[model samples]
Target: MKAIIAGTTMPVLELTLDAGERIIAEGGDVSWLTPGFDIQTSTAFGSGGRGGFMSGLKRMVGGGQLFLTQYTAQAPGSFVAFAAQLPGTIRELAIDPQDQFMVQSGAYMASTPDVEVSVGLQKKLGAGIFGGAGVVFQKLAGNGTAWVQLAGEIVEYDLQAGQSLLIHPGHLALYRAEMPLEFASIKGIKNKFFGDSLFLAQLHGPGHVWLQSMTPAKLAAAIEPYLPEKSSSDNN
Candidate 1:
């Protein structure tokens, strides 16, 4: 299978598959597809393995869909497309036994059949509470290619073993699964008006980290004041 990301802001993933080629993704992620494809919806593992029920439950609790959808090409030249939910970039990463990643909630889109996505739980309560995406992020493992959507522009950093970066939770997009994350309180800083906490996410790494310029929550907050309010009549 071949994957190409098209467009600028709000990019789309277009996948071209040969006969019998397959791709797996969370249910409801497909924006469009051509004819001559066999689609299966199930709770089974992306690799067509066992433990459908337990895996499904874990995925749902991790802010992912309970069912996964598999798309198979009936013949060569078949194609399927998935669009980014926000105005952002769609990135394709190569995954393998030695390379894995953890992604924030709503960042993952689709992957090859051999890839697996599971819950990546934060170790500390402080990191869980202030991380914006909660304790459970999506862990992408196994051996294949995976596609992810990140809001706005993407910035990449390759950190040395002892190097670290303090980040606002919402800006943390994706990172190497082996990286360690902790929370730090900003001294002398208080956000009483906006209800933001002084805590920030500190990620320590000997690996790569990707940060996004925008987040859904922050975008919503920026537009909330401009949105029309419901009237008393609409409530009825």
Candidate 2:
């Protein structure tokens, strides 16, 4: 199977499959498909293994869909495409040595059959205290290529061991398997109230991280003022 990533700013992923080649993707993410490809919906499975119903439930716990769509080519030269639901870019990553990466929920698009997607690590409840929203990232592992979609304008960082980066919870998109993801409170009582953010995420990496310039929450906040307001006139 061959995959082509097309366009910029709002990219699309197109896969050309040989007969019998199969791919698994996030449910509801498919934009189009060529003839001879058979589509099936199930929990995400890989050349590595197929997960059970309980696994599907677990996937949902981490903000992933309970069902995944599998597309297989019945004949030669079949094609399938996935378009991002947000205005952003699609990333093609290689997962070797069973590389495990944590990605934001809904960032997964599609992957070669040898790859697998599962629920990410759960955080402690105290982590979310004081309005600090802890994150649950989707764990992508196994040996293969995985495609992920990140929100507007990607910024990359490579940190040395013991070095850390403070981030807003919403801006985090993806990080390497070995990176440490932790939660921290805003320092200082005055800054807590007057600072730009009340809570922050700390990424301590001996690996790579990807952050988005526009998270959904940030985007909504930016446009909230322009949204139509309700008034007595609405009752008329």
Candidate 3:
């Protein structure tokens, strides 16, 4: 199979498959496909063929679909495409037993059949206690290629052993699964007095980390004040 990533700011992933080649993605993520392609939707496979129903359930809990869609090429030169939902970049990760990734929920797009998407983290201590929000991350493991969509500009950092970075929870996009991740409250009395963010994500690594500059929540908050307000007559 050959893959091509097209466009900028809102990229699309196009895969050209040889006869008998198969790819898997979450249900409804396909943008388009060629004719004569065999499509199968099931709960028992895709995402690495792990535990069937239980695997599907875990994916759903991590903000993914319970059903997975597999596209097979019946003839030569068949193709399928997946488009990014937001104005950002689509990145491809090499998944294997040694190299795996933990991606924020809703980041997964598609992957080879051997890749597995499972729940990584359901909640963080600081986020659960201070923020009242449960954060979810999806683990991409197994041996294959996987695609993830990140919002806005992406920055990559390679951390040596014992190196750490503090990140806002929303900006945390994808990182090596081996990296240690946790949430911690921000220090300094000035920040507390000024009502700054209470908690930040701490990631320690001997691996790479990817951070996105924009998130859906930040975008919504930015434009919310400009939106027209509702009136009493509108309510009626």
**Cα lDDT computed for each candidate against the true fold:** 0.83, 0.80, 0.86
Query: Pairing residues by index, what is the TM-score of model 2?
Result: 0.86
Candidate 3 TM-score, true structure as reference = 0.89
Of 1 and 2, the candidate ahead on TM-score is 1
Q: How do the residues 1-236 of candidate 2 rate in per-residue lDDT, one tens digit apiece?
A: 88888998789999998899888887587898897678888764632365667767777877788887788899888999999878899988998764678898778888887776777766643433323344678888888889999999999999998899998767889999788777776765344343643557888969899999888766777899999999998999
Off by over 4 Å in 3: 124-133, 189-197, 225-236
RMSD for each model, in Å, please? 2.7, 3.5, 2.9
**Candidate 3 residues 94-169, lDDT tens each?**
9999999999988999999989988888775443332444678999999899999999999999999989999877
lDDT of 1 at 76: 95
The collision pairs in model 1 are none
Clashes of 2: 0
- In candidate 3, which residue pairs get closer than 3 Å at backbone N, Cα or C atoms, i.e. clash? none
What residue pairs are clashing in model 2? none
**Best by TM-score, which number?**
1
Candidate 3 residue-pair clash tally: 0
Question: Candidate 1 — worst ten consecutive residues by lDDT sum?
Answer: 123-132
What local lDDT score does residue 164 receive in model 1, on the 0 to 100 scale?
A: 97
Off by over 4 Å in 1: 47-50, 122-135, 193-197
In order of listing, the candidates' clash counts read 0, 0, 0
